[model samples]
Target: MRALCWTGVNETSVETVDDPKILNDPDVIVKVRLTTTCGSDLHLLGGYIPTMRAGDVLGHEFMGEVVEVGSAVQKHQVGDRVVVCSFIACGQCWYCSQELYSLCDNGNPNPALTETMWGSAIGGCFAYSHALGGFAGSHAEYIRVPYADHGAFPIPDGVSDLSALFASDAAPTGWTGADLAGITPGDTVAVWGAGGVGQMAARAAMLLGAEQVIVIDRLPERLEQAHQHIGAETLDYTKDSVVAELKERTGGRGPDVCIEAVGMEAHGTGPQYLYDQIKQQLRLQSDRPTALREAIYACRKGGSLFALGVFGGLVDKFPFGAIMNKGMTVRGAQQHGHRYIPRILQHLADGELSTEHLATHVMPLEEGPRAYQMFKDKKDGCVRAVFQPNGASSTSY
Candidate 1:
């Protein structure tokens, strides 16, 4: 099998790899149909996230057909179309029982690394890093899905493959932020970064009945998509004062909820951004929290803030003072897609969610390297470069 592999820092290639087989009684083999590059993949590509070895397969968000089933996998069988969650979880853990699927105790098999780094390990994600179980990613023709009954959801009949693909990660991630950040009806919400996650977060806020939802970014193309597809207001941070404009738009109160979807590689104007970049490159900090800081400062006092972005490790100049003085609620988590994917799929089936527009570039598995370059550079207005590992046709299923 040919799969996309992370060759080195800022490098990727298509390489021949062994095909996956069912490894456990609870596992199944999925023939990937569509898999897409995610912003979080940039962290691994740039060497920000440690433990990513050369030749590690790269991808997580995907939808596919079940090719082979395991003995214990009852919910699915051969030929079933399913979208697997990015996070791998075992259904019987205490965390899974509590609906915190991403924090499932049995998820990450290689837990010592992350346990040492963050005190405790969270969950495993496909091809995220060695620290997250080292599972082969979905950027290939076949992927082994562990805990198939818990981690994969059936795509509803009316939802297209393109629409269901995002339910694997991006959309559920947005729902995680909005649902956990305590979004209330008639509240004003602001999301930083107009990428797929940010746009999805804005859409989630709107569906949650937020009176006003705003998405901020420097890209004209993403902002336009936010307006047209997500039906949210957009702000070009490069052209206007984000904090001031947000305050003005929200009647001097600022946004009731502020979500930061731009993670480690956040780009911004000013000395702070340069400082972050230099520090990150110098190995002084593992992440750039430029948009996160802005989101905190932009949220109204007593408002809620959610960090939906992926951050690997420590960051400098975190504003603990503002959080203390403003009485703000701050929360962050990986997407617990198992808890939300069913509803998201229903939304897609009902024609209430729009995700196909996020797939700006669709190519074959052979174009994996070029696709990652374009996606990482944000070139040609590429939001997400979708890879059809098995081919573009869905008729085979």
Candidate 2:
């Protein structure tokens, strides 16, 4: 089979690779259908993540048809069209019982596992890295899904991959971030970044009953899209001061809830610096604070600061006194995908959320590199891109 493999920092190539087989009793093998690139994949490409190696397949979010299953996989079977959970987990783990499958004792089924490090042998999507569990990604003809009973959810009837795909990661991650902020009816919520996750977080805040949702980003196209389609108010961080605008919009007190969806790959980088960092340990950041340092100061004293963005390693200075004086709650967790995918899918089935708008770009899997360039260059009005390997790919795209 041909798979998109990370050859080195700032490089990837489509290479022929071995087919995956069921290794765990609860595992299933799925023929790749609709696999998309994620912002997280950019980290591996840019070398922000140290564990990603040459030849590591790098995709996580996907929906496909089950081609085979192990005897222990009782909940599903071959030909079951399903949305593969981004996080590999055993539903029976202590963490899973608590609905924290991202922290499941059996984490990703990555190959670089040490007995102590891999916990109880659960894992996340392929190509993410050992830190996320080194499962080879689905940017190929097929993928191996471990903890199938725990992670994969059947795409409910009447659902399209165009919409169902977000259930794998972006929408749920947004929902988790908004929920962590403890949004309440009529509360003011400010979200940083206007990407799929950010837009979804804004939408999630709205769905959770926030009176107003303010999204901050530099891209006019994305900001406009967020405003026009998702019913969000917008602030361009580059053109305006996010803190002042956000505070003024919220009537002097900043949003009651603030979510940072932009991860460590801080925006505003040229190719040289971007490439230099690709092979080395690069700096991580909190774009929320970068956009609204005043958010900490301007928050409603007891407001919530939700950092849903992934941080690669350490961070620079943050306003400790601001946090101390405000007495706000701060929380973040990986998308507990298994816990939310089902409910999120149900919402999609009901037409409450439409990922079709979020998918601004779509192409064949062979254009994976170009998709990355378009997304990195911030071209093609790209918010997110999906690659379809099989002829059975979604019709809308």
Candidate 3:
């Protein structure tokens, strides 16, 4: 099998690998139809997240056809079109029973690293890192899906493959933020970063009956996509004062809900950003929380803030004062897709959600290296680069 492998820091390549076989009774094999790069993958690519060894297969968000099923996999069979959640959950654990699937106790087989770092381990995610179970990812012709009954959701006939692909991660991640952030009807919501997850979060806020939703980013292309495709107001942070503009737009009260979707590598305009970069590069901090700090300060008093972004470890200059002084509710989580994927798929099937636009570049698996470069550099207005491993042509889409 040919798959994308993380060769080294800031490097990736297409390499031949052994095919996956069913290892658990609830496992299934999926012949990947479409897989896309995610912003979180950048963390691994840059070596910010430790324990990622050379040749670790890359990718997580994907949709495909079931090629084989294990003895205990009752919900799916061969030929079933399915979208698997990036996070692995056993579904019968205490966390899974409580609907907190990402915190499932049985997910990450290699838990020593995270347990040592964060005091306890979270769930496993496909190809995230060795700290997250070291499962091969979906960026290949086929992938092994464990806990198939809990993790795989069938794509509805009305939903296109391109549309269903995001249900595997991005959309459900957005839904997780909005649903868990305590978004209320008629509330004003602001989301930082106009990427796929940010745009999806804005859309989820709108669907949740937020009176107004705003997406902020430096990229005009993504802002335009948020405005035109997601029907949310867009803010260009580079051109305007984000905090002041947000306050002015919300009648001086600020946004009732603020979501930060830009993770550890957030870019900013001032000395603070440079300082964070220096600290991160020197190993003084594992993450840069520029957008997160801004989100906290910009959030209204008594409002809710959700960190939807992926932060690996310690960050300097966190705004603990603002969070404490403003009486804001703060929360963060990896996507519990099992709880939200069903509704997201229904939304996609009914044409209520649009994700095809996020796939700005679609290409063959051979272009994996170039695709990652383009995606990481944000070149050519490339929002996401989708890879097809089954001899699918780039022009076919």
Candidate 4:
């Protein structure tokens, strides 16, 4: 099997590796049909997340057919088409029972590693890093899925592979942010970043009945997609002051909900961007939180702010004062994909949600390295670079 292996910072290659086999009673082998690069994967490529090794496979969002299943895996069998969650979970854990699958207590194989950094171990994630879980990623012909019954949701009839592929991570993560923020009718929402997750978050806000949906990013192509596909008003942060533009648009009150989907790799402007860049280069801070700070400052008093982006470590000069003075609610989580994938699939089946446009660049898995480079650079309007391991039909170029 050929897999995309992360060899070093900003380096990856396609290397042949051993095929996966069923390892536990709750496990199954999935022959990957489709997989895609995520913005979070950019964090891994840029060395923002820690504990990655030379030979680690690098992918998390994927869907496929079940090739083999353990005896205990009764919900699925050979040939069952399904989308697996990016994070692993144990169904019997207290958090899983509460529908917080990402915080499952018994998922991460190496809890001590994460506990030292984040104070506790999160649920195991496919190819995220050693601290999260060292599970092999999905950017290959096949992958071993643990706790199959809990994490794998069957693709409903009529949903294309392209649509189900994102339900694994991007769409669900965006939906998680909107759901947690409690978007209500007439609420105004602003999302930072115009990548797949941000686009989905903007669409989710509108679907949840928010009166206005605004997307922020520096990229013209992404902003155009937000305007054309999701009916969102877009702001190019590089061209306009985000805080001022947001305030003016909302009649000087700011948005009721602000979502930070740009994560640690946010491109900042002016002094803060320069300061964060210098600190990051010197290893003084693990995250560059330009978008997060703006989100906090731009949110209305008593509003909600959700951090949908991946932050591996501590940030410098976060505005705790704004949060305190304004009585804001802040929340973030890895996508609880198990809790949301099913509903998203139903929406896809019902023609209520369409993700066909998000897969902007599609190529065979052999071009994994180039695909990632284009995605990371946002070249040629590459919103989501999807790789078809089986070379299945694609929706777009």
Q: Clashes per prediction?
A: 0, 10, 0, 0
Compute the lDDT of residue 239 as modeled in candidate 4: 88
Q: How far out, in Å, is residue 150 in model 3?
A: 0.5
Candidates sorted by TM-score, descending order?
1, 3, 4, 2
Q: What is model 3's C-alpha RMSD?
A: 1.3
lDDT, candidate 4, 358-393, per-residue tens:
888878999999999998888988998888887775
Give the local distance difference test score of model 4. 0.91
Error of 2 at 28 (Å): 0.7
Alpha-carbon lDDT, every model: 0.94, 0.78, 0.94, 0.91
Q: Model 3: residues >4 Å from true position, as ranges?
A: 393-397
lDDT (C-alpha) at residue 96 in model 4:
96
Task: Give the TM-score comparing model 1 with the true structure, all chains together.
Answer: 0.99
How does model 3 score by TM-score? 0.98
Question: All candidates: CA RMSD in angstroms?
Answer: 1.1, 3.7, 1.3, 1.4
TM-score of each: 0.99, 0.91, 0.98, 0.98
* Residues 51-77 of candidate 2: C-alpha lDDT, one tens digit per residue: 777888878888888999998989998
TM-score preference between candidates 3 and 4, better one: 3
Model 2: residues >4 Å from true position, as ranges?
109-125, 268-289, 292-295, 392-397
Clashing pairs in 2: 46-278, 88-123, 106-122, 107-122, 107-123, 108-122, 108-123, 108-124, 109-123, 126-137
Name model 4 segments beyond 4 Å from true: 393-397
lDDT of 1 at 215: 96
